[model samples]
Target chain A: MNRVRRNKTAIILFIIPTLILFCTIIIVPIFMDVYYSFFKWNGMTAPEFIGADNYIELFSSKAMGFPRTIKNAFILAGLSVFIQLPISLFMAIVLARGVKWEKFFVALFFTPVLISTVVIGQLWLKMYNPQYGIINSFLRLVGLDNLCRTWLGDGRTALPAVFVPILWQYIGYHMLLLYAGVKSIPEELNEAAKIDGANSWQIARLITIPNLKPTLQVCTIFAITGSLKAFDLIYVLTGGGPAHASEVPSTLMVDMIFGRSRYGIGSTIAVFIIFLCFFFAVLIKKVFKTEVD
Target chain B: MHGKIGKGIGNKVIFVFLCIWALVQIFPIYWMFTFSLKDNSEIFGKNMIGLPHVWRWSNYIDALKVGNIGRYFLNSVFVTVATIMITTICALLATYALTRMEWKGQKLANSLIMLGLTVPIHAAILPVFIVLKKFHMTNSYWALIIPYAAFALAMAILICESFIEGVPRELEEAACIDGCGVYGIFVRIIIPMMRPCLSTVAIFTFLQAWNELMFAVTFISDSKFRTLPVGIQTLCGSYTTDWGPIGAALVIATFPTLLIYCFMSEKIQESMAAGAVKG
Candidate 1:
């Protein structure tokens, strides 16, 4: 009886603080978000119970502008997979192999990961400055002055321009992860393939790529979730600029909450963002399980 | 054989490609520092990469004055330290329980932590905001500190759990036999043994809190309460097309991370690799 009591006390002492913090920060807020999604409140005023009106407006109201942000997120997700994934994979493979001064090179590639997104966003904002930014200046020097555009100021180029810095920052991180994965593969496998007259490309395709499935799945899920939730870089770069050209759901929700003071609408957006993250997370987990099976 | 020569050439080609890619990686940061040293006119000049005509060291001074950079720095320090303290203690206890204790719902607790790994911050922001408002905690330290701790707990626990599992069960048994209770065993035996993993979690937690912008921007409206990232964003908006002070602020912001990376690159790499593998 005394031993049981002691064990109970230990468990209580261990779990209580964590439970309190998580409940307050995560569990309770999630429930609040669900509740707020059905209301009409501007944060300061009393919330009016509107029974799915917010979500209904979110789906149907072209003026509320959730679809555009969703579209931008989808485009960002696609570009991340199509452009960032391959480049990072190639860089990881090259960096992971027999090379002199590997550490220095790895650090060089990984530098961007250490930078805050706000700084990256601001730096790129200056970089893409139409008047005197380095990009345009270089274009003029190379006699391609006509190619220069107001990258962030233009509605057409805003999304692509903002994506560059995000891609730059994350590619190195992905490369580092993939490099670790690639390095874990036994060197003897490569040696055997080479001895059997397998070409370098064949070895990479058959052995290296197959072996990197787990890493790839991880990277893909991270990319998808990150792209969907991307806020800081976009917030800093253009504030979803040149008229909401690069608005992501998170940024849009932020604008609604802080900018417009529409807390309930913002919560609705937040709920949708959560749903999206959960959806992708579940899909990835399912895919990983199936691969294991 | 031609095959050997071809392979050697291929290796050299790969090396060259990687070096070029490295240049692309470093160029923006290199440009940032150079631009910071230059005056406003030179910053917007046609020759973007040229040496500064006059190195105005006062660009940093001016940026500091204009941005209230000192207050922002203090705010970041306070929030980051509080987050680290809360997260480290809570995560250590939870991780100890999950890994060492024979709890009935250990599986459920573990899954809860794992679920946190995928719960995007945006998902919880609305509810968190409302709850904070209800408690009149908005714009207070609790607003940022609590969420930062919660968000980081999953990562901290994951890394610590892996490290704790590697610790031998015999040590705990011996400590218990010596009349050390569960808490005592954790303090004297587990924590000391888990230093590397603890350091790894600390580094990641610090970086996450330090660089975080979204929540800071959303939660804190007062300028004096704003963290570094939010402060920098405000500076960018006010400075608009003026690249000189903006670049200076960015350089100042990036300096700490650069200094840490310069000295601790290998450790950071190893920790990150370990975390990725376990994750």
Candidate 2:
């Protein structure tokens, strides 16, 4: 056993490959993002350092639309927390009440989470097609033809149109998380509540909701950060299009780097996203901790 | 008697509501399949949600032949398989080392690996592209495989660490007493015990790599190396008027994930819940 413990070669062989890959792919890139954020360069030219200008332009330049993207992301994060999480909580509570086909419903709802975002985007794109889409067709069928508009085409409806699939896709993910939380609450508590003349609603409000705070906190963080990092569905759905009406930080970063070849500003957005995720994670944890205390 | 009747009615209403929600969840997928088989005219005018009347399986063939979905499908399979194999092996050995073996800086290594979780892949795109370009690895299979495996390691290791810790040390002690070396013990004792954890990691890694679009689109511009998600996106662009082929492409791209969900959903759900709790 001691000979095995002292075998340094075995340990190095086991750890080094993963360690190198992890660093190259995750850690080194993060530092490089910060370093690149300070420079001004297109991809073809040598980078020139212009410390703080990129950050200044990002915040102050109205034309750049950086603040608008942040506002868009905040809207998404707000919707995830307010709208998405509540639906998930409601479903979780109902399913956790030992309903029939509980496992079946959970799996059904989780189906969307497993599919590719590109596919979801394509599905919704066809759904929102003004001429042939099922959404408009159903609307027209119901004698509400006036209510149908160009969903992904117009600026007014495009943002909400893009946000719907993003919110809809993850309902099951948060539900599953909260369902596990709801299931983990000992059955004894619910049974005791029922015996004490408590109704279903009463048990849910007093016992179930109170005990779900930890899972709710985790769900909230995932929702918020997930919104912050949202790119794929939006990219495929609208390409942040109809004149950047639906731009988030990610799409904007991709456009800046790949579309416009401004690696410096792109890296700035990348670093900003990283910082925002960490900030919100710590902030949510602190907030949840204080509430628990 | 009145109260009992009302309670029964309420339960029925809740049941109906749950069924409606299930329909909402599953309807788009059903729509995808239906439209995939219809021509553009029927899809647009005659049949919205109904099954295709003619059943034009040729849309799928066109997606394969003209849209180059077959090529992209192979690319996705190769990348996903390589990613799963690499991530599974690396995460297994690394988890063993991080959890069981005694060494200096193990704590640092463990924390650093875990730190990979909170780091968003979006943030790493630029620098990684630059580094890969420097080495001329861009537009190659290694380009996607390397980053996909690297990013997957943190969660894989986390999942593996929890499972590996549960394996009894007595088995390893017995193996050692029989003069088995370190590699021998790892190969014989630990690897066999890790089958469930390996599959969990494999499925998780498989989904990420299979569905990944941003890197597939960015790192590899060559159509030869394009993946399924990127291929579907391209199909959508080129087949705008002929959305049937795009639908067919989407259905093709989505079949594997749906298959996984059909078979191993419970395991995936459990792994996700466990990962969330630990994270």
Following a full C-alpha superposition, what root-mean-square deviation does model 1 have from the true structure? Answer: 2.0
Task: Pick the TM-score winner.
Answer: 2
Question: What's the TM-score, to 2 decimals, of chain B in model 2?
Answer: 0.96
In candidate 1, what are the lDDT values of residues A1-293, reduced to their tens digit?
22422487888898789888877777777778888888899877789999988888887988767999999998888889889989999888777765877878888998999888888877787788788778988898899978999999999999889988888889988888888889999999999998998876788799998899889888889899999999888888888877888888988898888889887889899888889988997898798879878
Residue clash pairs of candidate 2:
none
What is the C-alpha interface RMSD of model 2? 1.4
Q: Give the runs in model 1 whose Cα sits over 4 Å from its true position.
A: A1-6, A291-293
Cα error, residue B39 of model 1, in Å, equals 0.4
Worst 10 residues of 2 chain A by lDDT: A1-10
Best-fitting candidate, scored by lDDT: 2
Alpha carbon lDDT at A204, candidate 1: 79
* Cα displacement (Å) at residue A258, model 1: 1.7
iRMSD (Å), candidate 1: 2.2
RMSD of each: 2.0, 1.4
